[model samples]
Target chain A: MTSGTTISGRPGISAEEFGYLAGGPGRAAEVAVVRLLEGGLLRISREGVVSAVASGAAGAGTPLEAYALGAARTGRMLGDLVKSTATSEAASALRQHLVDRGLVVSDARRKTWSTVRVLCFVAFFAAIALTIVFRVHFGVAIGVAVVALLLRWFAGRMRRPVRRAGRREVGRVKVAAGDRVGMVAQMGLLGRVGQFPRMYYVWEMLGIVPSAGATLRRRKPVRNSGDTGTMYGSSCNSCSSCSSGCGADNSGCGSGSSCGSSGDSGSSCSSGSSCGSSCGGGGGD
Target chain B: MGVLDKLGVGIGWRPEIDLTVERLPGVDFVEVVAENLHVEHLPESILLLRERGVPVLPHAVSLSLGSADPVEPDRVEHLGAVAEALGAPLVSDHVCFVRAGGLDSGHLMPVPRTRDALDVLVANVKTAQANLPVPLALENIAALLEWPDGELTEGQFLAELVERTDCHLLIDVANLHANALNLGTDPNRFLDEIPLERLAYVHVAGGVEHNGVYHDTHAHAVRPEVLELLGELRSRVDPPGVLLERDDNYPSDTELAGELAAIRGVLARHA
Candidate 1:
């Protein structure tokens, strides 16, 4: 049978029960599941498998119910399903329903703190205005502002993610130190002079350690034949470790040396179009 | 083709920094990220670069050419189509696997430097090469970690791959530096073994170090040492071209132009 088709006594579960199983079993999911189970739309199997009660002939259920049923029939584990986006949505909606109904306990301390925070911010602004206009003590104003910020920070410490409702917050993937540094560098924060100097030096400036910091200078201008210098040179000759044929013998195909810088006339190999014919259409390895 | 004749200096073309790219003076060519471009609707800035006769190389990042699984037909086809669409001189991808066993690692994974892995890479590269509209240049990638029992060095593996498959090498100097620092491989030894004649071009990008590991980040300023490495490679053989890659935290036009100028200055020094 299709997962949607209800058999007799298949444990009366609703969208809520399915959601609870699919979603995480935190207080939000738990409270929501209980409220919906009480509403008579949900049923629980003896095996604890949750499904929706047969509403009519075909046993059609809500999208959330069908999703949960399909997941269960496929033998999906609760641990796996909890991470799915569909489960998270169902759980969030159910949690919101419970919150609206006053079924779950709300945090009184958080609510009171939030109210106090708003008053504190208003007073803080007023203090700044007084300092600016009436020549109030600047240090006292600064102290008050610092104390207000600290109070808010402490209040924020008592907050719990599950206690809040609305948009579902998926946890961030832990970033590696290298990736984090790279990201900061990419954001132009590291590039700005004197910002994050230690980070900039350790990460961005670490490259200087290898090169021995030899300053580069422009070479003497040669005739524009594209023959800037001999392809093979004595540059590698100075190294005593140069064993793998790096010195004097690595001259490339000497075709491009005769070409002038003014045009592509003396060049032996055509750049893009020539390769298109060779590489495009067909070729064998 | 003589890569040096037309190429004086080039910058990697990213959509976010198109304005700065367009303003670069004496830019001989630009490397486009192949996966980002659709054959049907390529970005206008890239088209404009083509119109200006700046050679655009299709640098593919997702080919996973080192995977044990057969290279996907669609991916190869897409790259072929992009090469054709851009009229590219050559196409390039890393000689690293980004996925294995039907799961994507999301970043380039170092291939085990064993004969078996080499054989897999050879077959895959050959398959990809046959389908590509231009010659394929496989780049050496930066490995965050390496196999404990790797049978060959990075240079040996790449040289063998090039010898076996007749593909070109998109030698990323920064990657070589990163590998040398992080994995304890010899960079000069790497340069020594590789066939410099088959250089499709060169890639120079910015990177950083975190903790004790050096990262090829491509988001920061090019280090002087990287330029020194480029110069060292030049001392070995004259490359036809070199392209600068900057993937994020794009600097202002003035800063980018200055960096390009710095690259030009280095190339001139080596030339």
Candidate 2:
């Protein structure tokens, strides 16, 4: 009574029938029966009556006979194909293998590796975002993560890893605002030239530090850290709102690349990397 | 030790618990749902227990902090106000996303593990934290499906948020078990992997069976598997005090007593 369970009378009631009963809408008693059959707790005879199925036995009939008798359909099949010895945990893993291949539906049961992997990913990214917020270098953050993951992966191979799948996603960035950078200068003769307003029409700029419509003084640029007073922040990459989301006023500064000084490819830069994709992700810390 | 106060081991607040109200075992703490606070919810048909010494915790649902756009800042602000009024140590909300960019998933949809998403959670957490006096502790939700782009586990992601933001962890033991059951992972390993230092609270709730799937529907009594895992957590991780959650089927006080007794039994083994 390995993977296929056979029922005597109802010759075609596969464990799939038990799968439906175990999963489908049914009375508590009926569900219990389905569970018993599915769990290999019972076998059915030709009369359609149920009987206990021994847990320690090998296949007692044809695969279809095993199916009809309500044997463990998943167990023998996996045992034969993969390896001789398989624990319930291992069996569950094989079950997941089928689901992954789309042979079986996966919405019902949880898997340890998938759960652990997903949760670990969720926690890792969360930590990374926090690290980014603390201004930790992306390299260092990923480095630390790699070391930890390697340790865990190696450790799991040595010991039985508690496997589980968790589906949750969070990404964010925290950029320091409220800082000012460039100074304004009209394109006229040095120091305003004692002229009235509108004397210097060529005064285009970036980051008006002193006041409104001010021109920025050109300065040398460095990578990553703030050079021009604008602090960079990063979080869950998918932030929905920005202090000044895409709008008409974006023509000057906020539009980043579309302003034409930078390429549109480089336009959507935010707290961290170049932006331009849909920036809606986190709750915005 | 006893220095760690008990979390919400509230009256079962369900009829199943009611069955054994008179013979129910005693619990150390209790929590009343926000919906059941007023007479309109509890009604005169049910009498509130008179226990001044017992701690009462209030949990809220449907606060969509993960919504992309601002829906009602007032709603969030109001919930903060209530948690404050009640002197709750930590206000809890689900990590599931309810709406995005003004469109409703109509379910508690989870986001993918991208940097952009982390940013959103941090922003939302910050907003909620600023409004409330108490730190916000988010609970892990059970998801029937997953986003394709995820690169991390829910535990790792939650732990990271706690480590970075100083946010408290509300470890839901039942959710853990349900995840273990639904996702086919080793419960023992998951409990061990989570960063336990940030645990501020914990949850245990019963689940439902649908189409051979065990769902964290909060309908049944706290499953024994959940209790066993809680005990394991106590031994391995020194988790926060436990809370027994009975969301559906109003149970009698005595029935809740039994659930509490079961918890205490698990606790005694851990102790």
Candidate 3:
């Protein structure tokens, strides 16, 4: 709870805590599901329907995991599973604990701060309007507005749930997690899908198609904070258009080494070429 | 000592099954497609493998050494950067062309097996080798058609290329099987001619036959004939490394592990 408090003496932070610190309740739920899947307690079909493979909460390592496993019994979709789990009693309890530790802002406190901040803005604007209508001395209006502005700033600061200590904890956990799948799980769909593209079934089940163009445009070189090496740049301008031509610059030809061709060994055999037979029609060796 | 270091059985490191690759036991090394990766922003799984002291080889698909055009400098630089980043002992690409005359074929296309093509390939290989921080290993590809007027056999061409460039070889037995089935290129002839001492590793993958054409679809299970061919190669030389390539339609981790085990089995029996 405190800045100096240690979650454990172990190297990496727990996936649940890391998820909550990094992304909140929904992410924590997702991490739990990932854990269940990794532990072989749950199964997700290619269509994205998640089902509990194990009966009861026998193999679950945490309360959240047990809750997730129980919720998955009826075979909910991935999105639904995360949504329901986030609102579950277990997730609520976890959130309350974090709030008590001052790592997160309670919903009630956040709402109160938001209302006060809005009132401050309204009061400040009203004071200026009154001054303009009465043609009174502007100094009084300016002073009133300044006080309102100060109050608004304080409320805004209070509205943010994650405290400084929480941020520090998140960073520590991330560094310790390193390149492990635990880190990937903490990142939710983006990290899981990006690192494991073969899991496209997750997207298919979610009833959403990821835009290739958007994905390519948003892609930036991932650099660790400690890394000081130069990051290489990609010339792929458009994901859709570049498939056939982007990397095909004079720098090198973009051949499909996996595309079923004998060209890699200095032999002539192209499934895409005009010749369809075993030996291309041209000349004999 | 072997021509290359002892690299136990391995599998292709793909984005889809990254975690599976990490958990799968007995994986001595993993090969990554160079073009699919950005040297600056590598996937964490690859970095993890490197951190674990696992050999990560960058296999490029776009070097197009067999093309009539000059080797791409940017591509070579990228491959070199990847090798340096992973601290790999060597890297690999195919012996085919992907583009010609400013047009991209998008698939690996065979090069003419004449002296002229070999000269061009050798020059490109040397250029790539000079730029790369590690030794260059070239893999033979699976093809459906053979170009006319070829002057050399596949093994002779690869042997001459290695002799001239002092490069290494990544012989793909699955490709040899595909060629044998479709193009009538003898796998034994290929194994007999190439300098096995220069072999850095071997690639094994599964494929299917449709209408009598054996497609080197890395998606399928490794065919028995391919494993037999691997055994035949094992009979000739002790390859330092052997990797299973599964690019698409990935099976369960159990199936992949079984394939790797099958590869190990062949190596053990032949040994």
Candidate 4:
């Protein structure tokens, strides 16, 4: 679902390009990893370890994919995989390409903008000091301070790595990405860790916390026997109590017996009960 | 058996795999958990499926149809509203109680197979059916333990319920597999005794064996035995629809497709 041109007739951005524009090299690397995982070229374990099952496959078309495949050959943890891939020569080249297309600010330009903003802050304080010491008109000093503050704000905006065009391009990419792989790429470009419900485990494996105050709420992972966390207002201790074999001794009730209890007490078990698995012994609706 | 329109093959739709469900090839229908959706604001993914003419069935979990208490009107209302919103042909819930004595169990507890328990369940089902806009189908759940003083088997209990309430049945073979392994319930006997003509659909899911017990986890891959059970059911009747459910620990799309393919393969072989 890649598009070559935006609606405005400008060159559109690829998912990786959008990732770089939105969050930089690391984000682009994450998109590549997701692509490989979706393509079945790589495998991620429940523990978040990534291994390349077919590293020599012809699907490693992009440079980042090639780098990610190489990194996963030895079964690397997801966090380390992203880091190693992000710092690789391929990532550096991707950053350079985005800069060349004017979608992102150059490193030198961003550094200069940051320095100018600091100088503006210094000028603001200096003007206020001079006004108080030399008994100059308060209006003149206030004007100087206001101008310095405005300049500092402008410099801060200039220092942002992603330019206006780049943001627009990323937005376009998001609209065009309608399928599963594209949606995963959109999550990467938007810095939405754990936003993609199916891929949250991947982010958790990457050891990246969902960004603070993310718009989309982070959903609790699905409860399984493997997850001992609390769910549905109940805490599970172990898989033993939740198993179907918990009450094997009490299978049948006599016809005239008083065992016709309205509620099945064995259905839901507490943390202390022998059937303490809060997930209900793995039998879910 | 021809009462239900042919739904072919489908999968359970979850918020986690919205896009995957939307793009999965040959998806004839999808079942959404009724308790998880809001009628006023359905998910875009669901709306898209509806626009594409996919049958979106609402499967409720908290209905507590087998509870000793009367069926809750609010829960029934919500299920009805979801069905109406999705234009669903029918809706389904479990023949088990999730809450009783004002305490929520959070799991589908099997109803005791006693005449007294059956009387209460019949009354609740009729109440739910009267309030529901569309037809309601009840599914059999896998139980870790059965209540004592049982006067009937699982099949006889369901057959009487259908006779009393005229509700449909959603047979889950995986749950049958779990029961066959854990509680020694005879799947063949259940199939033989139940009224197959009243079956609206079939449910197939995956599970794992742990400590000599087969757990109906729905997180793992579908075992060979569960598929064999599906084959057995297919041998008895051509089910209107067979849906594959994967609730947690979702596999890759390729793996999920393969599972669906395996289910279709079993049906095809039996056919």
**lDDT for each of the candidates?**
0.55, 0.43, 0.66, 0.69
The CA-based lDDT of model 2 is what?
0.43
Q: Order candidates by TM-score, high to low.
A: 4, 3, 1, 2
The residue ranges of model 4 lying beyond 4 angstroms of the native Cα positions read A1-285, B1-3
lDDT of 4 at A77: 64
Tens-digit per-residue lDDT, B164-248, candidate 4: 9999999999999999998999999999999998889999999999999989999889999999999999999999999999886
Every candidate's chain B TM-score: 0.97, 0.82, 0.98, 0.99
**DockQ, all models:** 0.01, 0.01, 0.02, 0.02
Give one digit per residue, the lDDT tens place, for model 1 in B1-271: 5433456578998765564577678888998988888999887678878999888888888889889999998999999899899888788999999988889999998999999999999999999988887888889888889987888888899999999999988899999888888988888999999998888888999988899888888878888888899989988988878889998655555667777888778878877
Candidate 3 deviant stretches above 4 angstroms? A1-285, B1-3
Which candidate model has the greater DockQ, 1 or 3?
3
Clash count in backbone of candidate 3: 12
Number of clashing pairs per prediction, in order: 10, 122, 12, 5
Model 2: fraction of the reference interface contacts it also forms: 0.00
Per-residue alpha-carbon lDDT of model 2 for A1-285, expressed as tens digits? 233332222233333222211111111112223334334444322112234343313433323223322333322221121111111232334334434543333433213333454455565676688686898887788876776566544332221110111001001111113100001100110012123664331112221112112211111111222111011111101122222221111222233333223222343433212221211110000
Can you give the lDDT of residue B188 in candidate 4?
Answer: 98
Candidate 2 regions exceeding 4 Å error are A1-285, B1-8, B11-25, B35-51, B103-106
Please report, as a residue range, the 10-residue window in candidate 4 chain A with the lowest summed lDDT.
A248-257
Give residue B240's lDDT in candidate 4 (0 to 100). Answer: 91
**Worst ten-residue run, lDDT, model 4 chain B?**
B15-24
